[model samples]
Target: MKTLGQKIRERREELDLSLREFAKKLNCSPPFISDVEHGRRFPSEPMLEEMARLLKLDVAEIKRHDQRAPLDEIKRMTEQDPGYAFAFRTLVDKKLTPEQLLELVNRSKPSPKGGKK
Candidate 1:
């Protein structure tokens, strides 16, 4: 798996874009762009959006390369929120399919009178 910066750098290189040129498109300093491409910094949401547009790539592709929070942080969040913990535990325990998960999500939605929505 490539780092986010590596992905960004690779895309830029593929398009034959110089660092300065890419920075101009993103409205950021070249040094900042360099940092981002070297894994010393990450782009903000707006920057990521602009990068996706300029690179002609899906935003999801860029987002997919983003580093997730550490496991300890995830554990902390799960422990802090009882409802979230329960839902997550239930999901793990039941190993629900995508359709089943969708059903559970939709089940929480309010229906109009006569139980129709």
Candidate 2:
């Protein structure tokens, strides 16, 4: 879960641009860029848009952090899989181990053919 500031900094570093150099391109002060990178300030919408263009990053990627839903529902669904349910009851329920669950998932992977995996 990267913050917007971290995303901006990553993009800047990926381009190998110094803060001053990047600021020169953005027509802003290096202090302002530093502030944004340090999370002391947030860029305006227009500023974000411009930065996205300059940095070659997706605006949404820069703006949002990655998040995941809780795994409770997924766990319940996995419990219902007949192929895995026995293993889950016999091993996972008894020992609360995840080895069998991982093996079951690994077995389900499709073999790679011509296409990339």
Candidate 3:
């Protein structure tokens, strides 16, 4: 699996940008760009957004390249539970964006532990 850095580097190359050129566009040093390409550093959210704009990347594409754990965990849960399986299927059917799902989850109140409240 390619790391986030590799993915960024690939996109940069696809745009035919040299390290110096890309760094200049991003307003960072070449070394910082190199470290980010080599996985020695994580990019900031603002940087990520700039990259997304430059690379024509959407939120889903970026998340897929950077974070797979949430999807993997859901896959595991679906395999172990029929309810989860159904819910996963429903989510796919609805084509809900990750941001929308996150909003829904954030808005929900967690149930009280042990049914005490």
Q: Which of the numbered candidates is closest to the native, going by highest TM-score? A: 1
Report the C-alpha displacement of residue 105, candidate 2, in angstroms. 27
lDDT of 2 by residue, 7-97 (tens): 8888899999899999999999999999988778878889988999999988887766423333786588777777555754676456643
Clashing pairs in 2: none
Candidate 1 residue 58 Cα shift, in angstroms, is 0.2
lDDT score of residue 49 within candidate 1: 89
Cα lDDT tens digits for candidate 3, 1-117 = 577888888988998889899898899999998998887787787987887787787855765666424677877887888898888789889999978998877877666763222
Least accurate 10 contiguous residues by lDDT in model 1: 108-117
By TM-score: ranked, best first: 1, 3, 2
Worst 10 residues of 2 by lDDT: 62-71
TM-score (all chains, Cα) for each model: 0.63, 0.54, 0.55
Q: Count the backbone clashes (under 3 Å) in each candidate.
A: 0, 0, 0
Question: Could you tell me the TM-score of candidate 1?
Answer: 0.63
Global lDDT scores for all candidate models: 0.85, 0.76, 0.80
In candidate 1, what are the lDDT values of residues 1-117, reduced to their tens digit? 688898899999999999999998778899999999888998888888899889889999988788754679768888898776787788889999867887877887667764545
